[model samples]
Target chain A: MGSDWKVILCYSITVLYRLWWIPIRAWRLPLKNGERYFQDIEVPEGWHTSAEGRKWWRRYRATIIVPHALEACGLMAIALWGQWKQLPMLSLVAPVFVGMTLAFIAWWRHANRARIQRPQRVAVSLEERKLRTYFSWSLEAALAMLIAASWAIMAWRGDADIHWRWPLTLTYVVIGLIVMKAQVVKHGWALPANRTAEYQHWDEFRRRYASRVLDRMRFMNIVILAGYAAVHSLAGVAPIGAIRGAAFAAGLGLSVWMMIGIARGETAFLRGSARSLLPPATTIIDWKKGWWSFGAFMAGLALLMFWPER
Target chain B: MYLTVDFEDKRPLYQQVVDGIKELIARGTLREGATLPSVRQVAGDLGVNLNTIATAYRQLQEEGLVAVRHGFGAVVKARRSDFAGQDELRKGLRAALTQLVLAGLAEKEIVTMVREELAVVGGKAK
Candidate 1:
């Protein structure tokens, strides 16, 4: 514990920096990052110049900036106090994150409400909508299988009395998650303030982009949960300590990966330059990346499935 | 697929939906095998009742322009002009021609207009 003091201090400072950065970024969204924002959202041409666009921006700014600023101040006060008083500062991190998240939700809901009553012409694109459009079905299926097989193996070599508990409880939970993922994939959305035909196209593009990001996040979560599950199931097994360490390290690595994935979007926003909203067609089959990940996951599963008996 | 509902249109909402979709099919915008948005999706988008969109889809299915299968939603079957019998088409054509005549169009003018309308509905425009 004494030797780890420097690392702990460094982590707390990083957390404090991130907490301060969130609200500052949120506040600058309308000013410093405005152009990048337009690029990411692909607002229709002339949207920024139109009267309705100006009005919508006013409402949007008020909704986002004020609440976020207040939330940031409250978060910083608590975090600073915790740090100075030598209290358990890590507990403050989750509250700061949650507060920032809720602020985002509040503004998004407000923007959704500001869309005109009866959007009049609702446009769906010619192509069929599917989760597979944004996420790889093969990857999802592989995760489900990996989770089930892992839990089953854990059950098989169990302590006899409560061996069935994790498998039984988690199987239903996994099923529920898959269903929820399907439902939430392209469900309710906040339409852009500009609702032109071109904007509808942009909206579809935005939806797919957001869906892809969200699917990766969901996939990462399942991996993390499965890692924790693996840790629990192998807790007392000596030979599996290496496996356990790898699982734990992988969990932390993927948590950072997911955060970096989300932060990539924020970095694009803050870059203050227009990046192309339309990713070229050829790169889309990047769904191939999922198959690769699934293959690696399957390999790990194979190792674990056979390792138990040896 | 783009859809809109007018509060002021004298026609029933279901009829408007049916006609709008039929026009889209005629224009070749909705091609064979393309999936139509679900009835619930169209209804929610247009702020109309579910039955209105369902009736539109059912009418499309009966006309052979779309196939509405259970659970899979509706899919475009084909651009089915043959489904409309000759006499039924003539009656509608005669009413439109009569309106043009009442507006004092010359024979050449009426033919030109007919050609233009036909071209707009997927025929080759001269």
Candidate 2:
């Protein structure tokens, strides 16, 4: 009976967060980088709006919907079954499902690359420049603050076993450091003050592209941070070890899903830009560098956190 | 109709732009009286200089393929009865055939290839 609540809580947060994110992403679709904003694609003669572009968007929405629904249903069923049988491998199932969905998104982008509108170069306005810069630093700071707060709150409550606290703290610290490091990298590679007209044009587009991507990444981080807080808080509320473990696994899986989604988009962008006339301003940041560091950090932290508790 | 310019190609970018638009026009993908993307828009889309697009448009105007106006953008003009440039086309065909023959394509193969190209264009027009 106790485990049932844990499963429910875990699944509810995971599913609801993803459901919420999809609509937000679609609403901001026109704001993303593209040769023409999705909405700006030309319509046929005598038509005021673009019916073809609408169809394309509908297709994109449907593609995303099917995988997301499948993940939710599949993971919910797995979580329930795992709780009943005390299966260890069940925890691996959610990550696998998430991985498949992200891979599908990457493949879909590649397959449709030709059909998709090439990103257009637009003049970056003054207000737009300021807004992007503000969002960049603020979002990074907000995420770090959120993680640190969660760590502190969990420690102060003392309701959950502290045995896992050390590893959790370490995870938070490492993630915080990575976030900070990325900010420094951005600042270091800031667009030069004086540049040729061609380079300037390229830089404007690059900034717009980077800003749009960073905005999406920030939104995903919000989802991930919330997932972490929810699971960590479950310790005191649900005393059952099985239930707590299930919640933890669900939270961890969601984080991986969010990370993978961001990585997939960034990877597609990098690949698409390979043949571009203007490359990114500086050396491109490798997703591998960030993901591998995060992965190794998590693995090490998990060992320390879980082994001691066990 | 999309005008794709390959930055990596050795051919001059402006020439590629002109050729691409002409091909589209010949295939009927871009119909007469259609508005081509504005010079500014093309420059932005291709990440090339504004003058490059202007040069391409100017070449098209010379061929009587497109018309540029002050307020109005470049529009595909109807082909005149004379439809100039047949002599240039013959020259290009001669050069191409000479190369093909040198490369050992038989008379039969060259004729078959020309028919195939015409058929493809005809199919697209339909």
lDDT of 2 by residue, B1-126 (tens): 356555556778889788777777777877888777667556543456779978988888987889986433588896431245789778988998999899999999999998898776655655
Model 2 regions more than 4 Å off: A1-310, B70-72, B79-86, B122-126
What does the lDDT read for residue A77 in candidate 1?
A: 77
RMSD of 1: 10.5
Output the lDDT of residue A35, model 1.
Answer: 47
lDDT of 1 by residue, A145-228 (tens): 887767675665544444343344345444544554554443422222233355455445445545545555555556655654
Model 2 in CAPRI terms: which quality? incorrect
How many clashing pairs in candidate 1? 0
The true-versus-predicted C-alpha distance at residue A68 of model 2, in Å, is 29
lDDT of 1 by residue, B1-126 (tens): 565445467888888777777777788777778787677555544445678878878888888878897655688887774467889999999998999999999999999988887888665211
The reply for model 1, stretches above 4 Å from the true place, is A2-24, A28-119, A153-177, A184-197, A235-241, A266-310, B1-13, B44-48, B81-83, B97-112, B124-126
